[model samples]
Target chain A: MEYLLHIAILVSIYAMLGLSLDLIVGYAGLLSITHAAFYGIGAYGTALLMINQGFGFFTAMLLGMVISGVVALVIGAVLSRFRGDYYALGSFGFNVIIFSILLNWQSLTRGPLGIPGIHRPELFGISFSDNVMFLILCIILGAIVYGVCWYLTRSSFGRVLTAIREDENMVQVFGYATPYFKLVVFVIAAMLAALAGALLASYITFIDPSSFSLNESIFILAIIILGGLASHEGALAGAFFLIVLPEALRFLGFPSDVAAQMRQVTYGAILVLFMLYRPQGFLGKFRMN
Target chain B: MDILVQILLNAVIAGAIYTLIALGFTLMYSTAKFFDLGYGALIAVGGYATYWSYKQIDLPVWLAIGIGVATAGLLAFLVERFIYRKLRERKASGTILLIASLGVLTIIQAVIAIIFSSQFQTLSKNIGSTRTFNIAGGVITDVQALIFISGLVIMTGVGIVLSRTLFGKAVRAVADDSTVASIVGINSPRILGIVAAVGGAIGGLSGIAVGFDTGIEPLMGMSLLLKGVIAAIIGGIGSIYGAVLGAFLLALIENLGAWQFAGEWKDAIAFAVLIAFLLFRPKGILSK
Candidate 1:
């Protein structure tokens, strides 16, 4: 039961990332692979504040969001002019470059040794020392994020993003600056991803460059892809399902050595199969193709 | 002058390996309209296959390289037909395809690590380990010469196949529009199978050659892939000749950067170039 809740917490964290990514990749039709960089920013933000400046969790979390937003804004401004694969590569460069910083900037990040011993969030004479308690906090954050996404996706502004996805040239002709809409969506998504990162850092109580590599970004986006791209609920469901599936694969009595490899191969095959057979996801409103 | 010649030779060898990676990368992107980020893993796969064949079975040099290339081809065929081809049938988005490639990459790299222990392994045969000749006051290894010759052969062969053959036209047809190509009776699935297998084979050869030129490890593919991507981007994403030109340019700049600054600053320089290119010319040198 405890493990289940822990998985639920992970699902929420990834859902946080997946939903934000869906906004840019699904709604805005702008594929950015640098979401993990923003996620790293949040983790680093919280970690640096608590460790270095002796800041509290809530204040650090807020600052994490702000710092992530500003970074995303700068990257987005530059990359928004590009489209599709170009945009993806540009964002990818940002992700790799940031990862290099995390790996090589030994003084600040402690390099490959990683940042350990991050204290749990404390507030109002209470400490979030238990996994269950942390789970509760993450769920609440997840709900708030869901609410914001729900509002944005249903708003007129949200409709503009969807339209931009379908045909940005038309959106441009309609007098809505396409790049401007993309920038707005991208920034919001980056902020949400950073929030997830903060919650994740607090949960793990350890942070490393390994967690923010292109691999993690791809995994988060996989959750969105598997869950369906456009809807918040779909993203959530995808995260929960994929996370649980690997665990499910664990119980099948497979050998330990091959199990890990098979899990990934199976995971890749499943993703490809889903993309090939169910382009719309389980509950997506529109087909990905 | 000797130092300049040595650097130039090193750049060419590095450029040759980068070109192979870039070629494989460009082939998939141009045809599939997706980034198979997993191609890097295939490089690792090739290197390891060659390693095992040479180290464990004690296979001869030529046979070991052949086995490695064949293994890559097999892996590619199985993956595409079972994985990516299915995704195409469903008309999956580029992002979905991209994510799937990541899963493959993670799986493949992990498998290599599990088998090889993530340690850098030297090739059993040192084709150019000791053989060297001087050219205009600069020393050049036979392996460096081999890399140049093989790279030119592959590039020219690929160019000719793409431009002058019926098979090439079929590939172009399918690449342009699979549905329309199928309507023209091009058997796109078959063509896709061939190209994907070809890409894998090239990647594997690339891996072995690179392993001989440098060394082999599990994680090397990521940085190499990044360089290949940089080459593809600066040269234009989908063009073959563009990829060739881009590879040389990237290696030249990177070597120059490493020479000018510290080796640590070399990666940073390449990244800066990519950023500048993205900012000024999103379409790249070849501009689709």
Candidate 2:
């Protein structure tokens, strides 16, 4: 049961990641690989504050989100000038550059040794020690995240994002200021990613560069794609499906090494196949309208 | 002066590998107008293939290299014919295509890890035992010289093929406009497959060089591909000889940066150059 709770917490984290990505990718039509970079920044930000400055949970999270948001703001400012593949490349370059910093900045990031002993969340004189308690806390956060997604996608701002996705030049011609809208969506999405990262680090009590590699970024993108692009339900569904589906594969009697490879292959194959066969995704609308 | 000469020589060899990979990128970008992130994985395929062919089967080392390049090219061709072709047939968006390449990269890397266990391997068993020559106060290892010569010869050959051959004319025509080329019955799909195969082979050679030049790992492709893309971009993406020049310049800059600072700053220097280019001259140095 505790094992299941652990998986649930992870699923909740991924749900947040997927939802965050859907805003930028699905709604805003930006394909960025830097979401993981923001996530890493958030994780490391919280770790540093707590470990170095002795910050509590709420304060650290707020600071971490701000840090990630600021970084995203700068990155989004320069990169939003590009569209489509250029944006992806720019974001990818940014991700790698951030990754390089995290790897080589031994003095600050501790390099590959990683930070350990991060404590769980403490609120109102109560600490989240039990797996069930943590899961509840995470689920609440996830729900709040979903509500935000719901509200944003339902607003005129979200309509701007959708129009930008379909045709940025057209939106600009209408004096919609597409870049500003894109920057806003990007930073908001980045904060959500960081929020998930902070929760994940607190829950696991450890943080490493490995957790925020390009592969992790792709996996989050895959969750959004697999669940259905631009659909709130798909984000949650993808989180649940990909997280639990692999565990089911564990029972299929495959060798451990092969099983690992299969998981990687499945993630790729599912995304590619689904995109080709059904670009709208499992639960996505045929049209954004 | 001796340190300068040696560093220059080392940079030249590094530039050779970068040029090879960047050529692959430049060709695809020019012809297809999309980035094939999977090219890096193809390079890994070539490196591993060369290792397996020579080390396991006891094939001649050079012949093994040929097989590795051909196999990688063939793999790229198949992917173009199958997945990429299908996607292109559907008139899929560029975003979708890019994501698909990432998928290919993921699956191929997994296959490699499953087979090789993520262990770092070197293609050259006698790299350390190779002969060295000192000329004019600069010492050049046999492998280093080999890399430099092979890079030049292959680059020249590519230049000839692009100018003299009818196939080259078709490739250039397709690059200009795929629709017009297809109207002329140029077999766009087949041409794309062949072009992608050639790119993959070049990419494979680049990987093999690095595997022998340094060491090989499944994840090395990520960084190597970045350097290659940077070179292509710096040289004005899609230019034939521009990528070569860009590679040398990037290598020289990185080596000089390392010499001035520490080795860890090499990547930062490379990316800093990229950012500078993106900010100042988004079109690149060789932007034609």
Candidate 3:
């Protein structure tokens, strides 16, 4: 039961990540691979505030989201000039830069030793120290994030984002100010990613730079691709499937030493196969260009 | 003055490594027009192939180098023939190709880790036995000199091939316009295959040099590839001379920055320079 609840909490956190990424990659058609950076920012923000400043989880999380959003605003503005492959590369560069900061800024980050003893959130005189209580908190937060994503994608702004993805020049010709749409969506996605990060930090009670490396970013990308692009349901499905698939692989009983490498190999093979055979994905409404 | 000379020598050696990588990367990108992330995997393939040949199979160092280079080229050729060629036939978008390459990269890197155990492997048998030359106030190892020489030779060789040979002409034609090249009786696929093989060979050689310089690890490929890609972009993607120029410029800036601050800031400095160029001068120094 504990194991099951643990997986549930993780799935909820990653679902938020997937949904946030879907807004940028799916709705806005911007292949931003820096989601992990924002996720790390949120996690570190919450962890530092709670551990150092004695702030509550809710306050830290809100501040984390704001911090991520503000950084995303600056990054998004700079990234607005790039298109297609350049945009991906630019985002890739930013992820690397952020990771370097996380790793090298030892004065703040403690540099790879990682921050530990992160507290579970306490809300309204109630402690979420128990796994079940924490799971509930995660579910509520996950649902809020999902609802926001769903509502955003269903709005007129969402239509403009989709149009920009399909044809940015056409969207601009239609007077939508495509860069503004892209920037707004990018910032929102980053904030949601931060929220997920905060949940993860609290649940794990530890945070590290390794968790937000480029590999993690790519793993999140794989989730969106496998789940189906531009569909909220696809993001949810993708999160559940990816989170469960690895656990299912664990039961296959490969040698402990080789099992982890085998999982990675499987992930790589699956990604290549998906791109080759089903670029549109299982539940995606749109195919990545 | 001694510190300055040392820094300059370091910069040149670093530039040579980056030039080798960027040259191959630029070659592949010019023809394929996609970020082939799998190219990063080939760096590890080269390093590990040499390790296996030298240590496991007990081959001579020269023979190991030969096998390593061949393995990288062969693997690259196979990937182009099997995966990328099929996608090209389908006219898949560049983004799809990039993602597919990323997948291929992941698979190769994981397989490598599974086989090699993710531990760092040194190429040189005796690190202290290698001879070093003192130039003015700076010291240069034999391997570093070899890298510089090899970088110059390969650049000149590629320059000649691209400008003076029929194969080079065919490659340039395909890169400029594959459809038109095919219409004019050039086998674009075959040209692209040759280009891939050549690029892989160059990348493989650089990998081996890097291994001898600072040892090899399974995850080293990504960092090398990023630096190469940045250099290629900054030098102007398709221009061969531009890539070389970019490599040196990047090395100079990186080494100089390292001199001023902590060494860990090197990667950050590189990326900062890359971002600055991307935002301010997307066409790079030598736009094609």
List of chain A TM-scores, every candidate: 0.94, 0.95, 0.97
Q: Quick one: best TM-score, which candidate? A: 3
lDDT of 2 by residue, A1-289 (tens): 8889988999999999999989998898888877889989989999889889999987998899999999999988888888878789888878877888888888998988889999998999887878888999998988999999999999999999998988888999999888899999999999999999899889999988878877788788888888888899998999898889887767998788778777888888886787578877889863221
lDDT of each: 0.82, 0.87, 0.89
> In terms of TM-score, how similar is model 2 to the real structure?
0.96
State the lDDT of candidate 3 residue by residue for B1-288, as single tens digits. Answer: 999999999999999999999998999999999988789889888988999999888899999999989998889888888889988887889988888887788788888888998889898887899999999999999999999999999999999999999989999999999999999999999988989998998898889989999998877787788889999999988999999999999999999999999788888899888889997888899997
For candidate 1 chain A, which ten residues in a row score worst on lDDT? A263-272
Q: How does residue B45 of candidate 1 score in lDDT?
A: 83
Considering only N, C-alpha and C atoms within 3 Å, which residue pairs clash in candidate 2? none
The better-scoring model by TM-score among 1 and 2 is 2
Candidate 1, position B185, lDDT: 90
Clashing pairs in 3: none
Q: Give the lDDT of residue B251 in candidate 2.
A: 98
Model 3 Cα shift for residue A193 (angstroms): 1.0
Clashes per candidate (backbone, < 3 Å) = 1, 0, 0
Ranking by TM-score: 3, 2, 1
